[model samples]
Target: MHPGIIFFLVILGSVLFHIFTPWYWTDIASNWGGMDDTITLTFWIGGGVFIAVCLFMIYCVLKFSYKKDRKVEYKPEDKKLEKILTWATTIGVAALLAPGLIIWNQYVSVPKNALEIDVMAWQWGWQYRLPGEDGKLGTTQVININDDNPFGINLDDPYGQDDVLIQSDLINLETNQPVKILLRSVDVLHNWYVPQFRAKMDAVPGIVTYYWFEPNKIGEYEVLCAEYCGIGHYAMRGGVEVQSSIDYKKWLSEQETFKELIAKQQKIEFGNKKIVKNNNFLLNKEIYKEE
Candidate 1:
């Protein structure tokens, strides 16, 4: 069989395999935000160029292979040809990079009115903090973990008084919910990943990191901790249920009730219960702080 034909067949098979596979990430998300579209464009263009180059090389090798006693023809390297290839490569790279940088900039620059939520990761579970009605989530630490306080918020600071805290509850917010996620790690690094949202970010210990996304679709999506942490790495998973705004509020009310039950079950003091409840609630500057 001709090498050229074999090469083409091999590439064709690989492409077909890639097409038939139902892996989640490769398939487009339910929501194609600006960043998602930019990625698609960049990948298609770059991949086309890469495959063309490979196939061209393969064809050349097969066409120009040596034969017994075959006379070899020599052609001097053309400066003009070299210059053209150099410029082509340079321009191609720039074309590929420009959109990526633009989308990245948009991702980092959070909208002025995005609702902020703080996410904390530990050995085997995930915790969340939402600004109380006041719309401010105060800074937190880990030493406060107890029956009364799961997220050690510095209550003396007054800045943390109304922040709402949650551990392992599915929050269902209304459609087009604008959420800004603040990620932190208590012990080891972890990654918060949601395939349907096309969003993922690392939860590094000792440093706070985050990402934001709007859940435009209404459905339940699986959340996975992408970073390998320990023995329970595979089991470190969660779920996000996107719902209408009204439905989300209803869910929030239920969570509040559930939290109260949890406190009673642990025989936690009312004062300490207030502290933990405030850790996940929202608080605006006017009610909590001036800044």
Candidate 2:
């Protein structure tokens, strides 16, 4: 009797705690409500199974308690009981997995008209690339990466020259615009996650993975790396700001293009060499005069 009461109390406490818990899903700002639905379905199935099992245990404790006058019956196996248990277990497992499988099927299907944005991840930072007015992104290679070309932009590629290079961690998006995010990693593996968007994908090396979502809300959201890449993994954070089309265009215009970035780097390098040559000439004239 006492054990049955404890099980009842545990079930009651669990339900109450869940109902009043402070932490729950964040407000979704994208078009992935199916993801949330799948999660809610999982919770319901799991909670139902937990309550049913506990109730059975409570019944057994109260009705089958040991007594001095009671005699035990030894029936080792019952085919009927075994079949019922097997079917119940199979149905419960299937219920938990089917919703997830359905949602995952739609998660990878990118739309035809979705805009393109490239996200590059490193140990502790994020970089982005967006297509210019040409509506196309330039190809990149790992071998082309250097101090002057951090994004590994191929200088010879005509399409890459006009690509907008965003070095900042905070990226801007247009609300109601369907955009596909292309993920890449310069170093170790990382996962880009934005809770509000309900979308994230692994940034794998030497390959690209992608997912798409249309931002329906106009606001700023926190971006987090869901994978542990290294010691600085905790600090691998970024942000996204969804705005109106006019504001997004203004922000995009303010960003530098790959062509402009290359020109600036070249000017700096040339200026440094010119300064060194002038200093050498001055030193030579001074020695010649002294002689």
Candidate 3:
């Protein structure tokens, strides 16, 4: 079989496989359908280049194959060809990059009314903080962190008092509402990724990163750590549930505030100390009676 013929067959098979493939992008559940469009445009441009190069190779294989009577030309370079190639490459790269830049601009520009949520990541878990009725997230720092204040929210900041803390793996959002997620990391690097949202960002230590998305559908979406931080990285999973505004509010209402959590911890420690004191008093009385 001729090499040119084999290459032609390869191209045909590639196209046929692509058209008949069962794979496709996941359903767009957020307002970022533009992201999908941008990706598809990139695929078309890259696939076209691939097919063109393959066809050109096949053409050269058939047309320029060594022949007993033919002599090869020794042309060094073509100025016109070089200019055409340069412009083609520039246009191709621009076409691929322009949409991404536009989308990125919109991604970083949070709407004024978008709800703010803080996502804090650790080695094997996720924690969340949502602004209370104040509608403003308070200041936080790594220095203020402890087992009680896992989110590192400043205890001195009055604004942090009412901040709802969710230590569980599930986060709930209102459907059709824009949400700006502020990402943070307490221990190591991690990524908050939800495939349906088409948005993800890094959670760097001592820094806050963010992205926004509006869930257009009501469903449960799986969240995974996209970065390889450690051996337990694979188990660092979470979830997001998009629900109606009423349900979202109800869920939020049930979450504990930062102030409440601190008070609860204090009460537990006090009770433990009281029990120990009573036990010591009883032991001293028994010793005195024995003497």
Top-TM-score candidate index: 3
> What is the per-residue lDDT of model 1 for residues 3-22, given as tens digits with 9 covering 90 to 100?
77787877787677666867
Query: How close is each model in CA RMSD to the real structure?
Result: 11.4, 1.4, 1.2
Write the residue-wise lDDT of candidate 2 on 193-262 in tens digits.
9999999999999999999999999999999999989999999999999999999999999999999999
Clashes of 1: 21
Candidate 3's residue-wise lDDT over 204-263, tens digit each?
998999999999999999999999989999999999999999998898899999889989
lDDT winner, 1 or 2: 2
lDDT of 2: 0.93
Q: Which ten residues in a row have the lowest lDDT in candidate 3?
A: 19-28
Residue 176 C-alpha lDDT in model 2: 93
- Give the winner by lDDT: 2 or 3: 2
Of the two candidates 1 and 2, the one with more favorable TM-score, higher being better, is 2
How many steric overlaps are in each model, in order?
21, 0, 0
lDDT of each: 0.73, 0.93, 0.92
* lDDT of model 2, residue 118: 92
